[model samples]
Target: MNKFLAASVSPALYATKANARIFTLSSTEHNIEVGNWKIDSTQLGIIDSFFSIEQKILHGGKQEGSKIIILTSPNGLTITLSPTRGMSIMNVTGQDIRFGWDSPVKEVVNPTFINLESRNGAGWLEGFNEMMVRCGFEWAGHPGIENGEMRTLHGKAGNTPASKVEIEISEIAPYEIKIRGLIKESTFKKADLQTVAEICYIPDTYSFTIHDRLTNHSDYPRDYQIMYHSNFSKPLLEKDAQFVAPIKEISPFNDYAHKGLQDWATYLEPTKDFDEMVFNIVPFAKNDGSTLAALHNKDGSKGVTIEFNIQELPYLTLWKNTDTEKQGYVTGIEPGTNYAYATSIEREQGRIRQIESEQTVHFKIKYSALMNKEAVDKAKKAVADIQGAQKTTFVHTPIAKE
Candidate 1:
């Protein structure tokens, strides 16, 4: 037999759990599997050559007893998910572009571990720093009570641990490897909700998507409010950073937002006593079923574009909290089913949504970065199209008292 043929171990190949095909090589006749090579179905239109999922328990300050699930792609893209924090997306990074803010607290602690009820209801902000946090089901902001039941700021969804957590990876068409996470949030005789997130990465592309399915599991109908509080920090947000969106109507939650309305698209250097301002926005969606919002440095070399499903989540809230040199300096681009109002106010205004028993609502938000001129221009054009299609109106309302 030929030397190479004699070294062949077997005519059959093995498959890895990740669908990686492995071939065997041997040293001699009666050959053993001496060498093994892995072959993924790359030719099947997978964008990423390598994909991996890692889960670890976080330790150290504030993160003790918390769990983190990290998903990595071949192009140095990493997504961190916190199961303890309502399976929130804690970070999204690649190629030194940090789209999420890093908080002072290192650990994901249970809300019960913090004394958030103190300090006049400012305690819920303890774990407020995350990439994409969910605020809803009961209350989205401020301490409020309805029918003698009380809720703290932003509600307990962000802090409440998911009882059922699952992570799955599939090697199917239209994706190389897709990671899907299912987190279920339910309480006995209280709230029953679930958030299903599918992280899809396209082959040879730098963008990924977060498709979510939010379902209500309670027996009776219940009032539900949800807001996607996605935060961005430095590098992406700088002194001359510009915020572009297809805002159809803009208004201030208070005088602070009113003061910044004229220059709402511009950012300032960190300042003192910068009262956090909230701008309520009504965006105009293009034919693609998505509205664009972006924040980039003045040079426009690097930035992020968020394409949100405007059909499901119609309201957008922009938060500017450049309060101090530290522990502040962050901007939030939030889209939600209702305005960022307290449960009482939202209910009073009839802005809250009612989900019937066993009914589900879907929400989607896609994040893609603009690291070059072409990407930036594409975002600009998208914004211009949205802006040109509609006339922007202004609504000035008095701030709701906490």
Candidate 2:
């Protein structure tokens, strides 16, 4: 095969007469050498790709599309992304760099809402793993959930209530990897946008229709979700830990806690610190080296970056687990369309045009290692030109909630 999950091997999870339990166990891993970087994808659903972009740890493909791994160079520059989802810089710290203006978001809609990615759900690299965590970053998250009551990030098939997943390596790539799994449909009464039942779930699962991707293309598509779910070391977000997006400001939405309006100036470039779920829409980077969103360490110190191309996905979400009792120690920064099967407000407002069913949105996702904030700005602008405004308005204000 051109590529496949490395060390691919499966074990059962049904506690049988001898086992007498619920979940069995299985695993797979891969070691890839791409140029100067080495990548590893395990059956546990974890992917880690590393390279020397500069001094920083420029990485990509965290388990949950969260904090990406670093790929640094000598000049203290690097690039990272969940290109499969939406390429975004998970971290960058060093000399002033340039990536460019924010790219416009993209969306096209598909006929099937559940386009099964894989059975094992691509292991930990799978966004909906039992425990959502970084794909190729410094940390991975709560591997095997406890008591099956644990709330997983994306809540993959195996991680759900009574389901279990198993991954099968299919291919390996210089820029990406591929895998498959058996996903049993699940339901929960409290789950939003999710189906639920008493003691049964869907049984119509097909391993034949499964796939996954990871890339670093500058002009990638924007239909699928290109996100990053991360749980930085517990030390990262202590009241002072920071987070920033290279954009104007997050649009006011019902799902998040807001600090101001959509046009508020709270989105300062070179932000000293961040500690909330930030959603960015405006293009912040300029050719002259200017930005709108950025995260710094507490005390206005230095830290990592979390930026994405607006063209591919103008929308962004920065979720923080502030209340430990409520959640875990992770921050989800998803760079994609809001909610499921929705793009921006423009589509809802009839500004652009709504997508029809079965409309396949094709595009690319990219990641690089660059520590300069300026470089990031320049790169962002380059992407915007191609992704212009396909639609406008998020919900067309005043629409009665269904």
CA RMSD per model (angstroms):
9.8, 16.3
User: Which tens-of-lDDT digit does each residue in 123-143 have in candidate 2?
Assistant: 323233111222221111222
lDDT of the candidates, in the order given: 0.70, 0.29
TM-score, model 2 to reference: 0.36
Where model 2 places Cα greater than 4 Å from the true spot, the runs are: 1-226, 259-294, 300-302, 325-329, 339-402
Error of 1 at 389 (Å): 4.8
TM-score between candidate 1 and the true structure: 0.83
Worst 10 residues of 2 by lDDT: 200-209
Clashes per candidate, residues 3 or more apart or on different chains: 4, 103
TM-score for all models, in order of appearance: 0.83, 0.36
Q: Give a tens-digit lDDT track for model 1, residues 1-402.
A: 421122223455322345422222222234343222223334333554665555676667677667776767656577777767777888888876887875665457666576656656557788877888888755576676677766667766788665434333345544444444445556798778766545666544568777777677788887777888989887888787899998888888776678788888888877888788888888988776688898887788888888887878888889887766465688899888877766888778777888888888887788887877678888988899888857788876644544
